[model samples]
Target chain A: MPEPEPIADFYAVVPAGGSGTRLWPVSRAASPKFLHDLTGSGRSLLQATVDRLVPLAGEDGVVLVTGAAHVDAAREQLGLADEALVAEPSPRDSMAAIGLAAAILQERHGDVVIGSFAADQVISGRDGFEQAVREAVVAARAGYVVTVGIAASRPSTAFGYVRSGAGLGVDGAPSALHAVGFTEKPDAATASAYLATGEYRWNAGMFVVRTSVLLDHLARLRPALHDGLRRIAASWDTGADARARVLADTWPGLEKIAIDHAIAEPVAAEGGVAVVPGVFGWDDVGDFNSLAALLPSVDGSGTKILGDTSAVIRVESAGSVLVPASGRTVAVLGLDDVVVVDTPDALLVTTRARAQQVKDIVAALRERGEDDLL
Target chain B: MPEPEPIADFYAVVPAGGSGTRLWPVSRAASPKFLHDLTGSGRSLLQATVDRLVPLAGEDGVVLVTGAAHVDAAREQLGLADEALVAEPSPRDSMAAIGLAAAILQERHGDVVIGSFAADQVISGRDGFEQAVREAVVAARAGYVVTVGIAASRPSTAFGYVRSGAGLGVDGAPSALHAVGFTEKPDAATASAYLATGEYRWNAGMFVVRTSVLLDHLARLRPALHDGLRRIAASWDTGADARARVLADTWPGLEKIAIDHAIAEPVAAEGGVAVVPGVFGWDDVGDFNSLAALLPSVDGSGTKILGDTSAVIRVESAGSVLVPASGRTVAVLGLDDVVVVDTPDALLVTTRARAQQVKDIVAALRERGEDDLL
Candidate 1:
C-alpha cells in the first residue's frame, strides 16, 4: 500500500464553549463537559479528543474555541501554543464558534484543511475513523465543505439525518457518496422510517473544510456573524480582556444557529455537498445512558460505573455497594434501565427514557436560585 | 413533670451494634446505623441515645454493650468511664448481650435497676420517657422485670406486642389479674383487631429490671446463656483481659435471641411482669419510609431532602436528597418517592420500598469483588 498523505497538516477546531445545566456537578462554569473526565480515564473528553486528533494535527494545528469563562482551563487541557484558542465573549452556537476558529486558523496556516469536530463525542474503529477523515480532507481541498455520514444503527430521534445522492468522483475522493440532502432531526415515526430505508445517515456534527473556504462561505451566507468575527479577529489581545469585549459587545448579536443549519443545509440543497461514509464505531456520548457503550459495564446489565474513587459509591445494608465519587457507577437492582449519579451537592436517579430530560433538570435548578450548582 | 424522679438511677444496656446495609453509604462496618448523622443535627443516633440515657444513669453508671470492633468508636461517642463498656468479642444475640450487661451491672452496683434500650431508636417526650423509667425503676426494685410498652398507634407487623394485664397499682404488684400475657406480632387483620382492643403495646425493647431479678429470670429461662454470662462475668477483666476472654471463648457460644423471646415471654408466662403503658413519640425508625417520618417534613409530604450548598430541592425532587459531602451536586430529574444519595464513590437511586434491601446490594457488590465499598 502507498504511504498515507502528510497527516501532520490535518488540524482540529474544537468548539468547547457550550454552557449547559444538564451536566451540572461534573460540568460547571469552570469545568465544562469537554473538560470533564467523565469516564475517569485520566483524560477528559477534550483531552481525549486532542489525543485522538494528535495523529493528524501534531498538536500545533489543534484549535479550541471556548467561552471566556473557561479559556484558561481549555488552554491548560489542550497544551497548545499561542493563537490555538479562539476565545469567545459569550456562547453563541456552533456556527460562531466554528466561524471564529476558521478565521484564526487561516491567519496562521494558509488555507489548511481543518476538521471541525465536537469535543464530547466518542468514536471506535480508530483506523476507519482516520481514513474517513482523510477522505473528507481530499473533498475539502477540492472546494467542498465535506461532512462525514454515519450509517444508521438504530432509529434514533436525537440526530439529524443525511440522505445520500450519486457519487461525484473528481480527484482523490475517498470511499463516499455525493451529498443529496440533509434532514434535521425528525419525529419518532420519521426516524423509524428513515432507519428502515437505509438511505439515511446520522448527522454527527463532524466536518472537514478549508479555513479560507469556510470564511468565504459564511461571509456570503450569514454576513452579520461574518462581519463581527472579522473585527474580533483584528483586535486580538491574546488576553482575558479581548474575550470580555467580544462576548459583551458582539457574541449576543449573532444568530444562534448550528453550522449544519446555517451552512450545510443550504450547501446540500444546492447539490454541491460531499458525504464521507463511515462504518467506524462512533458515539456522541450524548447522555448518561450513552456512556454505557463507551465504558465497561458495571454489571451484566450494560450499566457503567465510573468515579474518581470507590468511596464515592455505597450500596446500603442491601446487596448494593456504591461508594461516593465523581465517577459514575450504575447499580441495576430489581429495577432496570435506571441511572443513579451522585455528586457532592446533589444526587440524580433517573430512567434512561427520561435521560434527555436531564437538561431540563439543570434548567429547573437555574430557575430555583441554585446558582452554585450551575 | 414531677421533678422527673431526680433521674432514675440505673445502668442502661444498648443491644444494637451490628451494621445495617439498608442505610449504606452513610452507615459502615466501623460506623453502623446508630453512628450516621442522618438528621444533620450534629449528633448521631448513638449520641442521641447516650444523651437520653446519661441523666437517668448518673452519667458514669450507664453501661454500653456493643460489638468489640466498635468499642473504640462507641467509647468516643459515649465518653463513658473505663468500666462502662461491656464489649463483646464477637456478635451474639440479644439474650447474651442482655445477660452480659446485667451481670456486669450487678457486680458493680448490686441489685441496681437496669434499663435495656437500643442505641438506634429515636424517642420524643423526654419528660414522659423519664417518668416511665422511674416507674420501671420502682417495679425493678419490687423484683419485677419492667417492660416499657409503647402504645401501638398502627397495626405494624414489624414489632412484637406486649399484652397488657389487668390494671396494676403504681407499685407494680400483680394485684388485679396476671402480668404481661403474650408476645404477638399479628398479621394485618390480626393486628387491626389487636389495635381495636387497645390492650396491646409495641414491644419497645426498653426493659427495666433489677440486675439480680433479670439474672434469676435468665437462669430459669435460658440456662445455658445465663450460666455462660455468669461465668464470663466472674472471669471478666473489669480490666482488658476479661474482654479478651469474653471474645475468645464465651462470646460465640451465646445464642442469638431477642429479649422478647428469651426472657420477656418466660416472665409473662410465669408471673409478676409489669407493662408500663406509654403514648410517647416512640419510633423504631425501621427503614427509609419510617425514617422519613422522623425528619421535618417538606410540603407536609412527610419527606426530607438533605443536600449540599449546590443542590436545589425542587418540587419534583422531593423524598430524597442526601448530600454526603464530596460536593457532588445531584439534580433529581423526575422523582418523588425516591431517595437519591450521591456519594463520591457510588450513586444509589432507590425507592423507599427497596431501600431496606440495600444490604442485598452490598452483598452483590461483595460477590462482584467490590468489597472496598463494604
Candidate 2:
C-alpha cells in the first residue's frame, strides 16, 4: 500500500478551543480537552487531529489556531513550524479562528481549498476520512461551502443534523450532495424521526471551502467580523510585532459565534452548501460516556479503564468507566455502568446514564468558587 | 440531668482489634476503624467507646486492650495509665483479647465485675446505656455471664440474635433475663421471623461478667487458652521485659476464637448467660452502609458525609454516603444510594445496598497484593 498523495492546493485549519467543562478534573481551563490524549493512543487529541490531516494536507500545509494561552503547549505537542501556528489574542469563537486561518492560507497560497477540523475530535478509518475530504475538496472548487456529514450510527441528540437534498453532479466528487439545511440537536423523538428519513447526517462541523468562497460569504453576512479577520490575516505574516498589534486591536471585538451558525446554516439555506458523506468513525469525545464508547473494554463485563489497568480494582462491577489518574488505586464494587474519575485534587463519581450531568457538578463547583478544581 | 454514679467494682474492658476490611482505604490495618472518627463527632470510635464506659466504670477502672502496633496511638487518644493499657502481641480474635483482659483485671483487682465492650461500636442515649450496664453488672455479680441484648430495631441479617428466656428476677436488677441461646446472623426471612417472636434482641457483643466466673468457664471449656491467658496476665504487671517475654511465649499459642463461640453460646446452653435489655441505640460500624445510618442526613436527599462537609459536592444524588478523607473535593452527580469513599491512597465507589460487597473489594485487592490499600 503506497502512501496517498496530498490533495492539491489544500490546507488543514485546526481550531483548538473549548474548555470542555463536561470532562472536568481531566479537561480544565488551564489545559483543555485538545491538549490531553483522550484515546489512550499516546498522542494528544490535537496531535492526532494533525496526524490525520497531514497526509491529506501536506505536512507544511497544515495550520493550527488556538488561544494565546495554549500556544506554548500546542507548539510542544504538535511541533508545527512557527508560520503554521496562529495564536488568538483572546477567544472570539470558531468564526474568528477559522476565518483568520482561511484568510491567511489564501494570502500565503493563492485561493487554496481549506478545511476546518476541530482539534479535540477522535477519528478512525483514515482511508474513509481521506475519501470524504478529497470529495469535499472537489466540491469546494465548484464554489459551494462543503461539510463532511458523518454517517449517523445512532439517533443521538448530542449533535446537530445536516439534511442532504439531492446529489451534486460535480466532477471527481460523486458523493457530494446539495445540503438543504441544518438542524440543532433535536429531542429523542424528533431525532428518531430525522434518522428514519435517511436524509439526515450528524453535522460534524467539518467544512471544506475555497478561501474566496468562505471569505465572500463572511463579507456578505458578517462584514465587521470579515473585516476584522482580513486585517489580522494581512499583518499575521509581517513579524510578531505587527501581528500582535493588529490581533490585540481587532480580535476581542470579532463576532464570537460558532462556524455552524455563522456560515453553514445560512449558506445551506441559500442552496450554496454541499454535504459529503463521511463513512469514517467520528466522535467529539463530548463527555465521559462518549469516551467510554471509544475505549476497548478491559474485561468480559465491558469495564473501560482510561488509564493504567493495574491501578483499578473492580469487583462485581460491570460496564464501569474508570479513570484512575491520581496515582491512587480505585476500587469499584457491585456497581454497573458507573463512572469513577479520580484525580489528584478532585474526584467525580456518577453513573454512565448520568454522565452528561457531570457538567452540573462543574457548574456547582464554579458556583462555590472552586476554580482550582475546575 | 444528674450525672450517674460509677458502678462498684466495675472495670470496662475495651478489646479493640478488627481491621474492618469493609471500611478500607480509611480503616487500614495500620490505622483500623476503631482509630477513625466515623461519626462526624470530634472523638474517634475508640475514644467514644472509652467515654461511654468511663461514666459507668470510673475513669481509673477503664482498661484498653489493643494490638502492640496501635499502643502508641491508643495512648495518645486515651491517655490511660501504663498499667491500664493491655497491648496484645498479635491478633488472637476476641476470645484471647477479652479473656486476657479479664484475667489481668482479676489478677489486679480480685473478683471484680468487668464489662467487655468492643472499641468500634457507636452508642446513643447515655442514660439507657448506663442503666443496661448497671443491670448487667448486678446479674454478673449473681454469677451469670451477662450480655447486653440491644432492642432489635430492624430485621438485620448483619448481626446475631440473643433469645431471652424467662426473667432472672434477681434483686436490684429488675430487667435481667436468662439468655436461652444465640443464633448466628440469619437469612432475611429467618431474621424477620426472629423479630416476630418478640424474644430476640441484637447480640451487641457486650459481655459483663465476674472475672472469676468468666475464668471458671474458660477453664472448664478451654483450659489451654485459659491457662495461657492466666500465665500472660500473671507476668503482665511485672515490668515491660517480663511482660514481653511471657506474651511472646504464650500469645502465639493461644486459641484464636471469637468470645461468642468460646464462652457465650456454650455457657447459654448450660443456663448461665443472662440478657440485659439495652434500649440505647448501638451499631458496630461494620460497613459504610451501617456507618451511614449512624450519621445525620446532610440534606433532604438523605446524603451522609463522614469528613469535611465542605469538601463534598452533591447534585441530584440522594441517599449517598461520601467520605472525603483525602483532603480533595468529591463530586457525586445523579446517583442514589451510592457510596464514594475517597482516601489519599485509595478510593472506593459502590452503592449502599452493595456496601457489604466492599469486603470483596478488599479481598480482591489483597489477592492482587495491594496490601497498602487494604
Model 2 TM-score?
Answer: 0.98
Clashes of each: 63, 0
The DockQ figures for the candidates are: 0.34, 0.88
Find the 10 residues in a row with the least total lDDT in model 2 chain A: A350-359
The iRMS of the candidates, in order, is 3.8, 0.7
Best candidate (score: DockQ): 2
Angstrom error at residue A295, model 1: 2.5
- Model 1 DockQ vs. reference: 0.34
How is the predicted docking of candidate 1 categorized under the CAPRI scheme?
Answer: acceptable
Span of 10 residues, lowest total lDDT, candidate 1 chain A = A314-323
Q: What is the C-alpha RMSD of each candidate to the true structure, in Å?
A: 5.1, 1.4
How do the residues B52-78 of candidate 2 rate in per-residue lDDT, one tens digit apiece? 999899999999999999999999998
